[model samples]
Target: MKLLFLLFLVINGAHAATHSLKYFYTATSGIPNFPEFVTVGLVDGLPISYYDSKIRRETPRQDWMAETEGPEYWDQQTQVSIGSEQTFKANIDIGKQRFNQSGGVHTVQWMYGCEWDEETGATDGYDQDGYDGEDFISLDLKNLRYIAPVQQAVITKHKWDQNRAQLENRKHYLTQECIDWLKKYVDYGKSTLKRTVLPSVSLLQKSPSSPVTCHATGFYPRSVMVFWRRDGDQVYEDVEHGEVLHNEDGTFQNSVHLTVKPEDLDSGRYECVVQLSGVQEDFVTKLERSVVKTNHGNTGRTNPGAEGSGSSGLIIGAVVAVLLLVAIVCGVVIWKKKKNAKKGFAPANTSDDGSNSSNNTAPKA
Candidate 1:
């Protein structure tokens, strides 16, 4: 009986030793195209026996574990011892898992198990709710997440702000340019006003009746003023000036009509003057009329013979002047002929006496 008891004790001790909880933990670089292996240790005093670990890409919903597994998923196991109490270590080899394209975070988790209730030999309920092994080893692994849309939004806002600033600067520059152009136009208009020419003045008509009416016109804007001065004094009550007429292009024209008797027309000079605004130019014109002549009745006396004798004497005098001119011309011709005859005829000369010296010397010799 004592030997059997001792053998039973050894068998129970061996089973107890095999039934202790097991634990393992691991970390990995969870880049999408490249995955690296890492080992982590869980220190606990209990002797761990079994271990299970997995690495996978995370999903959008929580119930993804019940669906069909993807190409990248966690691998779990419960029948191996990774390491011991002082230095428990695990190395997880996760094939390439794409985290960025998967649209979420990637993670790795470790699970450990032990034999619970050996009397009934039940395989289920070996691990606690939140515990992995004797000391509750856990690891959280995540990958880099992409948030490029937010950064793009910030860049777009900056660009819009810069564009708005440039537009405002352009508008201000154009406004200043328009203002300068308007000022130049105003200055040009002022100079043109100063250099404009005045209109020419002339007399149109004069009246000899009781009211002497004269008509005149002007071309400048403010050049229509009509007044009459009698002996250097202004007369305004009896004289009335007409309204000015404006042309299509904003120039002025006017006419003055005055009434004065023939006596007043012969009195003094009436002056019409025109003035311009921008420049100091004044045009003055003076007008007057001559007095009329009158003829009275007269008696005439007749002298028939005297008139006839005067006419006959004029005719005789004209004939005598013609005859005298002819006689003068005939006398000039006779004198010329006599001078030629004297030259042509030879003179009679004597040899010793002075009578026929030319004939004697030519023939006798």
Candidate 2:
């Protein structure tokens, strides 16, 4: 298996339907004005293969982004990426104008992420707003509660009472739109895209190549089911099911792994099944014992059996934290030294390393 991870079920709790809708908005300006643009992403648990904003249309999407965003023409970029240089420049000018007219901060920022896991559950979300690098407002979507920027204060202390209901209704409206969009996308995928991108299955084994994995990719709707079978019967003991993963092209990939004993490798008895709508027949792949090649890395993003087991996400988060810390420290040191130098004083650590001569006591950049 490329991504070697054993599933450990601490609590076999009932699972809610995996569904999420994320939205991100950003506005900035160099001209002392601010203009805002909004974009939303809809997914039925995971990414889909096609693009249709009207969602119910058998006809293809007509947005400029739709031409290269469909299953057949998509690049690596996902739907979450929706900004452009032309729009960015326009937004900067708009933001500058807004700032000048509104008589406030030089910049404005807004962002929100919303998710609904259970089919019947309420949508939960996080929202933030800022102006001129300072927090303007923040919200917790799950409880419809407001987060005060100051300590020992109720939301009323922030004047939210004046517009809380209206603001909350806006959040609800956004969530409902996402749900509607997701429903249409799911229907479209099952009825249309599912038949377009055929599943390509690969059997992979790591360097020493012991446990073989049946990997499936280029599928849609997030309704795929994959499992391992032995001699025409589903095997439960040595089988592990992966999560539905979002591919770069807005399609999805998944894998189910089986750890076969050395003696069973050559038996040619292991098979994997991938099922989806519009598939008249199931796509099955048999693990070839003689050719179970070494798996160098991940087969795209594999589904981990358990929730919150994102190795890649965690690693990226940690690396980002470290880099941010280093950058902040470097910025502070540079700012302080420059400020002090302007007052005719060198930094305390500006000693010459090679010699202690007075001539060598000149400033160092």
Candidate 3:
């Protein structure tokens, strides 16, 4: 009887040792009615047993004496006691470990088992009491590091967009600056050429002939046109062509030469007109010969009365020349008198000859 009792104790202990696993799945469970057998096992929460499966197929069987001990004994002793709450906790802990290892954040959820009632053919996973179907698990991710090349491509595209915006702004600023510079350059050019437009006239020669050549120079040659107007009539044939000179500062200088005959010069009016571009400013200089003779007559013939006046001028020039000559002669005479006075006042040397004569005469006595 003692041996029978010991055997009974052994059977009970073997029944109690039977274990079942609670697996964590993502979306579905029970293998979709395919009868694909799935086994579950548990690992300890301790660091040493973290990855080690503690419950495996090698453990003792649960239904060894089920026929003899009755269904009540099997129900009480053979059934594993894995709670839904415990399995959910384990799965969450494992998920947290994975997140820590990967340096990411994620949310975890567990789906309990569903039940089907045969009378109504209705599926139910949740009721007032609890869930009855196999558990399904899921994770919602946040801050997950992507391992694909598409992630890098997205980052590069964002950076390029920012850079393009900056480049457009810089281009707009530079274009405005360029326009301002161009306006200033044009204004400065106009101001510099405006100062050069003053008219100048010079008489080249006047002595030998009555027909004197008068030259007129003007700035802004592109805007100026030259012609000779004799007594209010333009003489195109007799007008001399002018030469234009270009300056370094984009302005021009031109000279026009005109030869007027003695009779025309004395009788008519000659005008030189200078016109400016973009402006209505016109400059005119008039040359007119005087009817009254000025020392020399307009005909290039010297009048006798004018010649008498020229002789008087010559007499005055000779008087000035005589005075200058007299002053020079007086200066020379004064210099000679001072030199003679200096010679007369100089002390005489009276030593050797007088002393020798005196000594010879004394020796003879």
Candidate 4:
């Protein structure tokens, strides 16, 4: 599985008010030491709550969510997730039968979410399902039908589409109920969600001839852009943009590498620019040999703002954490199918790295 996450785009302007609420449900079979079912709920790209078969309970991941919600809320959510767990377990069996697989590791995923633009009063909702790391079916809200990408999913699409009541209920939940909950969450966590923390940028390299890497860490909201600029213009060629990773303390980190010739490095015309959400000022780091820290013996100079010699270790740890997540995920036969899908569904070439109440109804597959 090529696990990748582009959680949210960088929302520009100080008054930008776009928020999203998403739920990811994964059910697996034949995975040792791992939960058979897992659920993650994110609001504006930050995990707010989590549930798993091992825990048998839905718990808050964010302090604001825990503090704002009471026991009754969690109890209700736990029950909702419990019901979903049962449905997904059966769904897995159905998927296996459809794929004609008798045994081995397998996974079934359901992604449903909604996005709201507070400033413009626009709302959108999506629901999608995947079997064995491939797109299966998704709900088309406009037409009120199910779209089946692969032939195996045709029966399921027909079955689910015929249930107009369930379709309407899902549509109402996604468009109306989901947005209401998102607004409440945004209100409850406004203090923490609205807060901004500036990033600490650094320049690092392993050798003089190696590419210069610009690393930014300790930022919040998880929406930021890092790029290499040469002579006041953005440099796209020979530049690699790294994924945004979560820090231990809930902040985020990102990196960009620029391969430059020795002569170009000497010119000092290149700089790294970081643009963070809701921030007016841009963080810039000049590309100078003196400012670049290298691991080559004692010739390197450390940036006071950086984590000193341990900076490389921190970067390595972040990358390893991402790899470990990918490694632990249950393996399945990668399916290749193409079909038009809704918001929660990804394209055929890409697979998503894979919930609650009454606003508490169990999801029906």
- Residue ranges of candidate 1 with Cα displaced over 4 Å: 1-194, 210-218, 247-251, 278-281, 290-365
State model 1's lDDT: 0.28
Quality of model 4 by C-alpha lDDT: 0.69
Pairs of colliding residues, candidate 3: 21-40, 113-133, 113-134, 114-133
TM-score of each: 0.25, 0.41, 0.25, 0.81
Error of 2 at 276 (Å): 2.3
lDDT of 4 by residue, 1-365 (tens): 01211211232222336788877777889878888887777777577887788889988889999998889878867776776777778878888888899789888877778888878998888888888888888889888898998999887777666666666767877887778788899898888777788877888888778998888877776678888889998787787767666676666777888999877776879998888877888988888877777786434333334446336535664775464244324221132211101212111111111122231333434
Q: Report, for every candidate in turn, its global Cα lDDT versus the true structure.
A: 0.28, 0.43, 0.29, 0.69
Candidate 2 per-residue C-alpha lDDT over 122-211 given as tens digits, one digit per residue, 9 for 90 to 100 = 655555544344454566555565665634224332444344543455465446654554444544444343334556566677645466
Q: Judged by lDDT, which candidate is best?
A: 4
In candidate 2, position 361 carries an lDDT of 15
Q: Higher lDDT: candidate 1 or 2?
A: 2
- The C-alpha stretches of model 2 lying farther than 4 A from their native spots are 1-21, 24-163, 175-195, 231-233, 236-243, 246-250, 277-280, 295-365
In candidate 1, what residue range of length 10 has the lowest lDDT sum?
A: 337-346
